[model samples]
Target: MLRDHLQRYDPVFQHAAIGMALISLQGSFIQVNPVLCELLGYSQQQPDSISQLDHAYQDVLSAVTEFGGSLQSQPLPQGTFELQIQQTAGRQLTVTIHLTLIYDEQVPQYYLAQFENRSLLTETKTQLLSTETMLRDIQDSYQQLLEKMPLAVLITRNGVIQYVNPAALQLVHARDQSEAIGISTDEIVDSSYHYSLSERRKTYYEHQTPLQSITYLINCMDGQQKLVEGFTLLINYDGGPAAVGVFKDITEQREKEEFMMQSEKLTMAGQLAAGIAHEIRNPLTSINGFMKLMRSSDRSSEAYFDIMESELKRIELIVNELLVLSKPQSKHKSQAVDILPVIDQVVTLMDVQATLKNIEILCDKPDSPVQIVGEVNQLKQVFINLLKNGMDAMASSGSIHVMITTNEHEVLISVKDEGSGMTAEQIQQLGQPFYTTKETGTGLGYMITQNIIHNHGGSIQIDSVPDRGTTFTVKLPKLVSVEASSN
Candidate 1:
């Protein structure tokens, strides 16, 4: 009776778009529509039924068999699944397969299977995945550009920072962007510039200036102070007025300008001193010759002539030191000069003075000569001046220790004095022209010494403690030798 009823609808099922098939419990095809044959690339001699031996529909048959087994123990409603079917032309199609069991008085009779194509759904899903990938790439590119920007970028509302890029976090010495977010912008700004910056921010919000530029001092989390040139834009953020600032550090630039100005002033002062020294030295030389003749002519005035001669010699000494200070530094004759021999020569020259003051001179040097490319005479002058100062600092007796050490890139020469040390205030005043600690000392010595070291691309550091002693460490780059490459 069921077969007769199904046969009555054969005309409707034969021409339907969905593929349909009828199969018996023994897995043999009872009947198949033209649509089913076309979908499987079958001829009029289509396969009898679902078969596990066929590769194209093996996956579908396995699922159908499992469904059919479940129908044996209990009645089941229609069920659906999806599978990819390959035709003889090597083309593939995704189809949804629906299965229903036809029972004859509680005994399994046949399975009615239907397949609906799902090719359009697969195409839409593929397009969606490609679009998502493109969007993610665009977002990553935007994030990379922001991180690589040279200037620091900050976005704020009501003085509270809302966003800070990596550059901004680095500018403020923040560990990361999270540390800078939600913090008050005023906290990082230097106190002196707080009111001014705040006022500018207010002006932008009140009138919507759109753009403004200013320079201010900013204090970093690491305790460093910087002068930053900021360009700010007034923008709408989250439906309210906001300020976006881009800052470039200008501290080093400003310092360079000031140094150039100071250099000009020093040049002028040197020219004036040179002229005055020349004018005084000529007259003083003639007076000294006349005093010498008078001392030789009569013993009665000899003692008085001696006193005058000593004062004249002191004046000459001051004039010579002044000339040295006014002289311009030259690097043309620099060579790989051994620092050990130079230090030894300076020690020999000052050894007599040290002995007279009951002081000992000790030297520690490596066996190999420590070499640097610099003016040999200037290096000698530096060691001599520093050693003399150490001798002068010790009133009665003490030892002067000079040590030389070397590393891969540089050489370190340290001069230590066991004498009355200097206070912090006194140390700060060092290297200034016309500033000295000793009554008879001329402050130009240290200033000239530092100038020579700086010209050689070296640096000097002094460590002193009150009532103890002082140590001056000089660091100079070592001369590196290049080995010839083998041909």
Candidate 2:
């Protein structure tokens, strides 16, 4: 029966796909399959000449002897291990070997071994581990950069906040990231802008588009409102799409702008008051003379009273114009203002200044009322800036022509000064902040004027020649009708 069993096992072991071998307890090969010979690059006749198995034999022997003297009393033990082996040509190959002990009549006989080449599998796993480590390093570096950025940054997905950087937390006065994360974007943005923000987010997600720089009023945790200018774009995060917003706090910038505007307004008022001082005094002198004549005479004449009243009204108009220009303005109030009256008032206020400089201001009023929807005070300031710029450009006595013309869609008011004209380069730099041709000019006036015109949905253009003069043409959208303006 043992002979028959050996005959059955020999064919199966010899024809096995994997390398197979049978070794004696003394570590000498009892049988070696053709597959084992090929795997070690050895001839079938040299089964005992496997020098590469020398080191592996020691380990196998040690493992088998661990069961020691009780091997026969206990169940037969099997062991497996991995090692690098040398082929016939000295090439190194990694392999896994499985060892099992065979028992004959309940006595240890030989060891059965199976070998599997793991060189390619080992190389592949090593490459995968290296790639994973590199990716982890890159992610760590990116996270560090985001943490240190000064600009406020946040990430959101499906309109829910996912991340907030330190700057973002400070901007909204949040205690920590936990206070902001998981909150809806609508909760952070002002309620007035919720609809617009929702629509913008919807459009971006639907089309995978990026949002342009826009100003937002953020409702802070501390019940403070902050203005931030930011842009949003879609980014891949954790294998999914998310929106990353980069923002700059513009609240201080806007406040500074308002403060500058107010400063310019005061400066202009001071200049206007100085220029009209004599005009105010002339009327006051006339009224004083009339009062003296009435006090000395027995009775006051109706014509004298009329003259006094007219002089007083003149002083009052001048004072009122000065007050309007110098007063603190309500930044948000706007109405349909007739352009003609605004120009007339500006001309009247500036006329005395022009007269002092020996410059005549000629205003050509339109027959029909040309009206525009804007803040009246801002419009007054716009004209004041233009007229002052015109006056400053002149060296000597010259006329400043103010012309009002209209097209089907817009109204054009041109202030042409017979002063030192500018070059094309100077004209190009007209609206830039802190760029001025005058020795005493702040250069904020034109910039503020340009901002106000743009806010009113209008534009200003300049035409100049070196020796001739400069013309500032302001184009404003014409109000369609009284009813339309009211609506």
Candidate 3:
């Protein structure tokens, strides 16, 4: 009655869902339950008649026996694996058989074994493999994204590469992943850029002065050279001294800058020539007058003198033009001129021409002056050029908005147009000598405007969105007390 009650109350021990077996100290199954018979496809043969020493691998089972016997008292070791057995089935199976040894009264002779079907384990393995495949697919997608990016992405801390994206690897031409990581930038950068990087490192690390908006150099992995301009900042990476830097490969930009630099060299010569021409003009004028007087005195000598005098006068006039290339362009000469008045004046000058195309010129101006420095007339010239550019950019009819603001350090004068703006590549090429977007454009307008502003101590920048619009911003320092005194 007690045995029936035990079987009824604790069915798990007597009639478990899984196979059960009893293993002896000699690496053999002494007995197995009905479930074990079912798991191994065995018939209801007596378990006492079956001994399977070969079913459990002799070596591993021996080790398992050793480890199992040495355990403290009650609980079995978890995460244990062993290869073991079924004699009646006549087939060997790789299984994870869990066993608990019970040692109480009779020489510590009993062991309880649970047999989980290898097929079920196999199915579980297959499900895990599918999940692993999905994880691998996700990793592959992330790798592709890193490879295709246009920007060079690097994660570092105080200039150590914690991470570098594939684009950076391709650009720098690192052979493999091992070559790229934890290597100092000095390894790849040229000797010239090495010093610059050191200075930047000092500024950032020792000084603790952040370089969030710094432009620095990077030598690419390829044999081809580049000046990589980047912005760097300190960030946390799994909580460490993480720095992130994103940069563009600026080899082409540097080439274009070289062209601009050449143009600047030529312009500086023009300034010197203009200064020299001013002194030479007075003497040349007197010399030409005396030659004219000599020509009138003798008829035979007149043509010869006339030719000499004419050539001299021509040279003198050319010198005068050079002198007027700029005038009193002193950075000091400035006035409180409202931008609205200036825009109005420019529109008046080009109103008839703008009307020809049926274009509308719009002005969003504040009542007060967006007052900066320099001459009103000079600023009017800048306004006229920009307005005329806007008008010319449109095909049939379009709008040009002159946006004036007291926005920043300098009064901002913006000329925006609905006409097709330049591409990023084209914008980078703007302000270059003889580099214009227009069919008949000389490309000297912005160059001249830039010079005019420089003479008045200011600068200009352009922003554009292709097929949308272009915005030209003129920033000149506001005329102040020092400027008044200098003038």
Top lDDT hit: 2
Worst 10 residues of 3 by lDDT: 1-10
For candidate 2, what is the lDDT?
0.81
User: TM-score for each prediction?
Assistant: 0.49, 0.53, 0.38
Comparing 1 and 2 by TM-score, which wins? 2
lDDT of 1 by residue, 1-487 (tens): 7668577659867678888877656555556677887777776454543342244565566677677667666646467778887776787888888888877777677888887878778878889999989977976896687679888999898889988888898888899878888988788888998889778867776776766688989989999999999888777665787888899999999999899999988885885477446545654776677677776875446665676676577677667877897688764488889999999999999999899999999999999877799988899999999999999999988899999999888899999998899989999988755568987766778988998999898999999997789999999999876541232
Whole-model Cα lDDT per candidate? 0.81, 0.81, 0.68
Q: Give a tens-digit lDDT track for model 2, residues 282-372.
A: 7799999999999999987999999999888877765665554434444657788899998999999999999999999999978888988
**Which regions of candidate 1 are displaced past 4 Å?**
1-260, 263-304, 483-487
lDDT of 3 by residue, 172-267 (tens): 878766778898777666777777777877887787767755455556566566677787777667567676777877778888999899998789
Tell me which residue pairs clash in candidate 1: none
Per-residue lDDT for 47 in model 1? 51
User: Given candidate 2, what's the lDDT at residue 143?
Assistant: 85
lDDT of 1: 0.81
Worst 10 residues of 2 by lDDT: 63-72
